[model samples]
Target: MSTDTQHGESSLLIQLQHGLKREQFERALHDIRAGWNRRELWMTLGLHDVRQRYRRSKLGPFWITLSMAIMVLALGLLYGQIFGQDLHDYLPFLAAGFVIWGLIASLVNDGCQSFILAEGMIRQLNAPLSIYAYRGLWSILIAFAHNIWVFLGVALWFGVDLNWNLLWVPVALLVLLLNGLWMALFLGLVSARFRDVPLIVGSVVQVLFFITPVIWKPEMLPGRALWLDLNPFYHLVEIMRAPLLGQAPALANWLPVIAITVVGWAVALFFYSAYRWRVAYWV
Candidate 1:
């Protein structure tokens, strides 16, 4: 908070700004790039998103969690019976998946539209494109935190045991957030070039939801379990669900998930860097 510290920080950021624009990919890579107080940026952007979301509603951010719970209840009651799954066990599984999926869906849906949605601020202020994407990511995380209330409710309602595996929940969330950030950076940058990119992402999320195992269990797939390996969403859902279910994913499950997220993240950074400068003008 000292003037000296502020000056040093500004100088450092300026250096990054210069290096960032040296090429296309690096510019977008600047946000989550290591050694730049990444935690602080995440926390700051997260708070900004929360404030914006609650600014309109009197109950503010709690509404996000509340809305998420309602959706789960509605879907679980209907889909549990339709799928012939018992609501007692099924509701808890569905609750965990619902909260995590919202984070994924929001990241993709909002990432595809992050910059466009933040246009007024982008144009009026010297906002980093990554910050805009972070807003979307933060909003989802906050909502996920709120929806976690359902985790408790579901367990108690079904008389499920709260296990030590629940401690791994944060690790799973980090994986989800990392993937979400990549989606936001890559899609947000590209979508700016083609206005329809947002619409396309929206449609894909809808189509993929049915294909992915949200309403049902992965065990329902029969011999096609190998096919589930191909879905990034499946791993994402499993990462969160496994922990709460007291069956935390093995290294085999997570090694691949981490690899996939890293590769996708690198690709998105490339696109973001390649297109970051033009984003201001595009919006």
Candidate 2:
């Protein structure tokens, strides 16, 4: 009995010696690095998601473009009437606002749930939290591409010119992509922990729409609307819209978005690094 008891104690000591806190950190690093290497997984998964989204529909991918165009037309006409604006002048403006805001909103709304949406694959594979962030980014890219139809329709209707200023469009999109990743990283972790983020985000976004200059022109408000100067989202939207209107975006617009991005990314990196493990468990 003494020999058997000693053997049991020795076995536990061996196990404890083998299991160190350093090993836990190393394992976590490995998972994060593996995730980085498999970055393509997010792109692939995003494509699969896009395909699955319209798989059963007769129109397939075109459905996304067609649907967005329909929405822009319906909403522009309805809201322009409600606001007592000229349909011709307001339609293009409304189209630009709607499409850009849709991309931003989708990034915020779905980005939070990115990990939750990708849980099945995350479980099967050892990867980095960044992949889920990329998945959310790619999803927004797909939607934004589809939303281009709103611009085409607006241009056709109002002769909205796309000139050299339009070149800024890509730069604006890059800024948007950066913001999307940061939001996905931060919000994704929060949603995993709380499970109520989607609902709260939805309600907040709905209110934010009326507060934003989507249907109404910024000029409609006096000095108070200058408050938009402080909102990074307002600047992000303006940078995208100004070029489409063949004008340089206000220099005032650039700083806020960049500042928000710098601070947001720093916060996001820490949040993702810390909460990444909890995400796996939550999933």
Candidate 3:
């Protein structure tokens, strides 16, 4: 607390801030790298979010599992009849698609609120902005883990053939998780600045659920298979759902998905680097 010591500490703080201000890209990189280095902190925050959400409920996160199971069964039965597919074959496909879609849709929708939801922490703490994004995505991963149990149960009940192709599922899920990271960073920044972004995201996700082939199959659209080719969400779902249902995804699916991943990250990084410093103010 001596005068010279206090002066030195103040000078150090100014130097650090000035260094960060020197280059926006470097500042953004530092934030992302620092957030990764502080995995323990973000992981703890992610777990805390899950706990807070299920605090007083007896079933806790299983409630999500139950709800997902009900949706799959109800849709599988209704849509199976509509699409003229056997229930046994249709249920497994529907279950896997719905489970994967739930994760993808939730990540995109929730990414919109990642920063805004953590407004108080951003204002009062010195953590990197990307830390909130990481935490939000981690929470989504945890929820996905819970919801996937429904798929397992459906698979068991239907006796779907298991093949070595199932091994690719983890890789596909990892790719989706990578997409989730950039999405959280990009959408979080935009949503913090524009309050309407989350609402728009929600509406889009709702519409996509019907059109993205979750309840129906591509075979249902035989003449215009191009529709599935153009839908990025379909590509995402196909990469995992096809493998889970014991079929290999086409090369076409992987090509567009990888391209989108690269382009999406490029766009996310540019805006995140440029506007990251403004997040606290916006939120």
How do the residues 10-113 of candidate 2 rate in per-residue lDDT, one tens digit apiece? 65345435433465446545655666687677788888888888898898888878888888889888888888888777888888888899988888898889
- Return the top candidate by TM-score: 3
- TM of each candidate vs. truth: 0.82, 0.85, 0.90
Candidate 3, residue 46: lDDT:
92
Task: Compute the lDDT for candidate 1.
Answer: 0.77
Task: Show model 1 residue runs off by greater than 4 Å.
Answer: 1-58
Worst 10 residues of 3 by lDDT: 12-21
Compared with the true structure, model 1 gives a TM-score of 0.82
Consecutive 10-residue window with the lowest summed lDDT within model 1: 28-37
By lDDT, the best candidate is 3
Give the alpha carbon lDDT tens digit for every residue of 1-283 in model 1. 6355557646535543653655545544554454134456656766876777689787788887788778989999999888899888899888888777777888789888878887887888754667777767777777777878987788788987678888888888887888888888789887886899889889988887877788888888777677678887787778778888788567767877889898998787766665667677788
- What is the TM-score (0 to 1) of candidate 3? 0.90
Our tally of clashes for model 2 stands at 1
Error of 3 at 232 (Å): 0.7
